[model samples]
Target: MSAIELEKDGGLWTVTLNRPDKANSLTRAMLEELADIAEAAVDARVLILTGRGRVFSAGADLDEAKAGLALSPVWERLSGAIAALPGLSIAALNGTLAGGAMGMALACDLRIAVPGAKFFYPVMKLGFLPQPSDPARMAALVGPSRAKLILMGGQKIEAPEALQMGLVDRIVEGEALLDTARGIAADTLTAKPEIATGIKRLCQG
Candidate 1:
């Protein structure tokens, strides 16, 4: 089966990390594919990132990371593509988000996760720095010290705490996760393209 799945429903593009057995841990090929999808999503009015099963992603595949995927530029490329999207981007985290997987979610315009989800980035203990834009994007959402607590201190944050810290925008029930994300995208999906894109641009400013 494909590790990544892309579904296009008109201007609403949903990207799903599909390797549930692997906790959807990203591989180089998966990362590249995700980057490609993001880059090609320019015409999308809304993009929703989510995963199957009980975990969004556990970051790089261990074997691949041992071979240097940990420092690959594709991570940055994928996140950058998502961040540069003119449309609204939402990370509907299905479950825990850990390690480098944090980058893509951090780049999204809004993040909403299930109540059981946990958030952590353990680059410090793993002896690798986060993707180029991760720290800044993370800090922009959660303040420097909190970003430090997760990155430097390697503290795992629960969904409620994540929302309180401004990391996640909302905590939703597992069943309602994707529905909520879709609801949030409804306005963007129906708005005139230029108007939606303009609001996104202005907010980023």
Candidate 2:
């Protein structure tokens, strides 16, 4: 199966992590596939991110993590490319999100987490610092102090707690996450596309 699956239903394109057995841990091929999809998504009105398994994503693939020997440059650059996609991006968190997985969700413009899903950004847990942009992105969403608490403590927050901390826009039933994200995307299509793109660009800037 393709590590990354793209579903196009009219103006919306959903990119799904297809490695259910691996908790959708990002393999090198998956990352590159996503980047290519992002480039191809410019014409789409909305882009949805989710996973095939119950767990949205466990994190990076350990076998492929050795690629960092070259300085992890590919991961950072590909991540920015996906997160900065011009179309509206939404993450439907069906289960646990940790490590680099947290970065993936935070990259989305809005995130809807399922009842049992949890979130943690534990770069420090690996004894490596977060990418410079990771902190800035976190600060933009949840502010400095809360971001600092997460980064410093490497604490994992449950769904309700994640909502309180502004990590997710809403908490929904596990079965409803994908439906809710698609509904939001349909709603976005009702607005003027240029205006929406402009606002998103401004926020990214």
CA lDDT scores, all candidates in order: 0.95, 0.80
Candidate 1 lDDT, tens digit per residue, 1-205?
Answer: 8989999999999999999999999999999999999999998999999999999999999999999999999999999999999999999999999999999999999999999999989888878888889999999999999999999988999999999999999999999999999999999999999999898888878
Q: Which regions of candidate 2 fall more than 4 Å away from where they truly are?
A: 67-71, 201-205
Root-mean-square deviation of every model: 0.6, 2.0
Report lDDT (Cα) of residue 11, candidate 1. Answer: 92
Candidate topping lDDT? 1
**Model 2 pairs whose backbones collide:** none
**Which ten contiguous residues of candidate 1 have the minimum total lDDT?**
123-132
lDDT of 2 by residue, 31-146 (tens): 77877877777788898888887899887786776567213655566568668677788988889987766766777789998999987777786777776567877888888988
In model 1, which regions exceed 4 Å deviation? Answer: none
